[model samples]
Target: MTVSFTETEAFKTFFYAGEIRLLYFLMILMAIDIFTGLAKALKNNKLWSRKSLFGYARKLLIFCIIVLANIIDQILGTHGGILFVTIFFYIANEGLSIIENCAEMGVLVPQEIADKLAVIKNEKGTSVTTEIKEEFTSSHSRDLEGDTAEVKIKIEKD
Candidate 1:
């Protein structure tokens, strides 16, 4: 006898919650981040047993947060807004970490790009990743208040 799609564990865990794609993407990012991180650590001879375990635990916690956000969306009778935003935030973070890991392995990232990534990662808040977006928007608006013509000239020069 064939089981219905909804009867499967994968469906219940992911499709039912409308987060299968986001979860899958997050998992992929997590795996890449972990592999890059481990490679960097091994290169530097700093791969502590407890630290690696803690890093895995932290990834698990990130998954739990996405699950919690999905539940929150359900309770509010909304779609996947919360879960999507949460996953997107984590994805950006993991992507930045991967880049940093690659740089640590002597991959030669541009200094300006590395500095900007460092600023984003070092932002302190309950949602540092989210705050980076807000800060960027605000900074852009502030820039607009200064001479738009001058900015245009600067952009043209660049």
Candidate 2:
């Protein structure tokens, strides 16, 4: 006896009608970008219109690029593997950009993690054992006193 299971309605809903996990993550990223941009503007006491515009443009471009890639994949009759690869590359790039933008707002990201990501971007491939080594080292080790990251803020008094 053979059992055949087709894609569920729930999966189809997420892929087309609803939000996929990556899309939800991207939405969170967008919120962070907007909040950080607003915080920076307020901190500097500057009423810059470009900041919001820039953040919006980034979000729009990311979505547009992903959609375009999906369209191309459909035309070429390629499975979503190609689209997923494109999404992965863009996700990493956008993640890096988000970190940089947050850093600009005085939210410091861990140096070691950032450096590791930079290395990954540059390096070819890591051996299985090497991946474990990369995960253990962190510049913000102190922040993870127990198991969670505790962000420290140094406020200036006028």
**Best candidate per lDDT, number?**
1
- In angstroms, give how far residue 140 of model 2 lies from its true place: 38
Best by TM-score: 1
Q: How badly does each model clash, as a count of residue pairs?
A: 0, 0
Across residues 1-158, which tens digit of lDDT does each residue of candidate 1 receive?
99978568665455346656666787899999999989988999988776677678879888778777777777676777776788889988888878878876889899997777666564352235435434555455686685645333334553
1-158: candidate 2 lDDT, tens digit per residue:
65323245543322322225666676776677567667766887874675456557767877777777766666576767656777777666557656655655677679986565456543555433235434444544555677866799999999
Off by over 4 Å in 2: 1-19, 114-158
List pairs with backbone clashes in candidate 1.
Answer: none
lDDT of 2 at 143: 52
Cα miss at 52, model 1 (Å)? 0.5
Model 1: per-residue Cα lDDT at residue 146: 52
